[model samples]
Target: MPPKLSPSGALRFETEEHTLCGLCRTPYKSCECKGLKDNLHDWYVWHGVPSTMIPSAKDRIFVGLPPPPDNSSRTKLVKRWVSLVNISMIMGHFDANHWFSTKWESLNASMDARTKLLNEMVADYVAQLPTNTELTVLARVLGLQRRAIAGKVDGIAKEAWAALRIFLSGDWACMSKAGSKLLMNAFNTRDPKKYPRDDPHLERILDSGVSRIYGVMEMGFDKKGYCLAMEPGRRPCGVGTSTTLETSDERLISKKARKRKTTKESIPTKKRRRVES
Candidate 1:
């Protein structure tokens, strides 16, 4: 039951005091049927039913849910009911906390604070790269490779925790029934064989939040805790999650040719067995 749009004539709130919403039967000033969600889809799903219909858990999820604590930063603030234990926790809770909703605005403020000095440092480092000019690279170097294959996982234990956390949380709604079932089994049994590693992309999903060749490899809703394309190494993921309607790369190895030519100082010799003492 979507928000009932009266066919004939909807009740007009003429700034009248104590005017109850015609749909929810609650005061127009405070309509619970409108729901606590920020988006229309959630409202349609959870609060669409009229006041006459019995409200389910979806309708009552935010009835007593507390918001994030007052703090300058999410990292510093202790988590509340918004743990990654369940995906439904995202609604009316995670966004209100500022961890995922307005993270970019906060990050941008921090970037502006030190961009000038940081750029100066980056440029200075870039100049130091061996055979600095790109034109010279056409001769000696074969090709540049991303650290993807060679990179090491940041922390194996933490990576597993993060992957399992996402799968457990209600975020699996978007996934197919079969896929979700498989993920559930893999997580539940704690068996690597249960995972569909042959999928190839499975590795990246499990490695979410762990460091890759670039920054944190990601596959979910701001799992890195924030989203920003700060460097060529790191890029933003959940682009549209932000509430605001916003208007808003590196070099390779370095080496220097030895100035003085030197002769071989040492030679390798095969070890001889001492048969006789």
Candidate 2:
């Protein structure tokens, strides 16, 4: 038969050696058991936990009280998580172009006039660019340009408008200080005399160059036409003899003749019939 267990809660053990204090595992009150218990009691006291298992009304009330409100760190973490989820959902709809056409159309209909204006500015900026630029260059340029523009505008509202335009444009390219400074200065000044009136034209040039740079950057294309940017040495200039001959009339005829012979072998001749309905 199994040995009868001790009646003490959480203290029952199978062996005599294990019959020591459940908490300290030392001989009950004798050894360091009492010291350990006193230390635990002091800890509970410091932490505001009741020393006794049974509670007074005050103890009960304290125990029943909810925890204090979350601190800013906790709140910030929660917000970050929510933001990440929202961003992931948004990213699901966008393509390589960084646009969700359907979402954009719906938004365009509902958005305010300021929002519409910002979107148009971005669209026009992107439209001004040719398809050949590197993407990295475009991203950097766009960010720099936007910052410059925002710095010029005094009000937070105007800066926000400028920022929205940059985001929508999807132009990320590295730009020189000269170009960036020029844009920043122009954006901040409202006076016609201080700033050039030809903003639309200037904006177009900036936007297109930025977009092309971004595309090239993304493709890892060098300043030269070579695919890899880091590689040195000039790429061959003209079409090679092998490439030209491959597209010549003789090559085309031979390919066509081979296809025809293959098709003839695959199919059987059939008798022609008169159409009498």
Candidate 3:
């Protein structure tokens, strides 16, 4: 059976021990983080998931991130297609490993502005897929970039460079027999800005996601237990929860404040007795 994503924050998921944590990702994407164990106290070590505080991939198909709990202040913004189009659109903060500085303000002010652009790109890619199965897209993504035993390819325009960048730098190797470094290298070099507008890699990952890219499906987060799910035999523990959201922001602020306060404190003058020697 598929997972149930509750809008009230009461949800249950079922997947085998070795399977993906089944959140914020497609078969083509990778979960580089850990998930919450059923216990809710200790972290889930095996198949982990990304943080829910940010957007997550949910709904058997598309929708940006997880839909908010019943009482979230951000409710007005739920289900917005652009919310999850970029994969890292979770929490509205651009993850550095994916997007560098200065791209934060690139969100479309109005949906109308992005509709045509996204549609054109997606239609192009969807037409070429021989089989719409998850494995097919995964195969393409892997073939387009790197292979575990064989290593990497030169360019990244074939994988969702325009519509999405699914494979996380750390997680892409989950399906490969080689080290994940190859995946990371391919992802890092796939910056859309680096490629020209004519590049064909920028296309939708799955044909089924058109409605999602167009804001038609439900979305949802949480399940840090994704690392091991990607690779059955790998040692994927301690894939800790993402503290990258507000907690991290607060810590950074507090650190700066402490530094300022310390500087403001007057330094006592050394006693003249030292000169008597």
The lDDT values for all models are 0.24, 0.26, 0.26
Candidate that scores best on TM-score: 3
Model 3 scores a C-alpha lDDT of: 0.26
TM, every model: 0.18, 0.15, 0.23
The alpha-carbon RMSD values of the candidates against the true structure, listed in the order shown, are 27.9, 31.8, 21.3
User: Which 10-residue span in candidate 3 carries the lowest summed lDDT?
Assistant: 236-245
lDDT of 1 at 66: 23
RMSD in angstroms between candidate 3 and the native structure over all alpha carbons: 21.3
lDDT by residue (tens digit), candidate 3, 1-277: 4545454322223332112223322321233333222333223232254434321222212211233332322112222212222332222232322331232123222222344444444344433333324333344333422343222221222223321221211111111211122222232333356433343322221111222222221111222221111222221111121211111112112355435423322222232224322
Q: Which lDDT tens digits does candidate 1 get at residues 1-277?
A: 1222122211112222312222222222334444323333454467565534432211111111122222213222112222221223223332424433344334334434433432333333233333224313211221222222212111111222222222222122111211222232233333345444453334433332112211211212221111111111111112221121110001111122111100100111111112211
Candidate 3 displacement at residue 113 in angstroms: 1.6
1 or 2, greater by lDDT = 2
Can you write out model 2's per-residue Cα lDDT over 124-204, one digit (the tens) per residue? Answer: 433333331432343333232243433322222232232332223311111112222323332333344432446443334
Please, what's the RMSD in Å of model 1?
27.9
Report the Cα lDDT for residue 214, model 2. 34
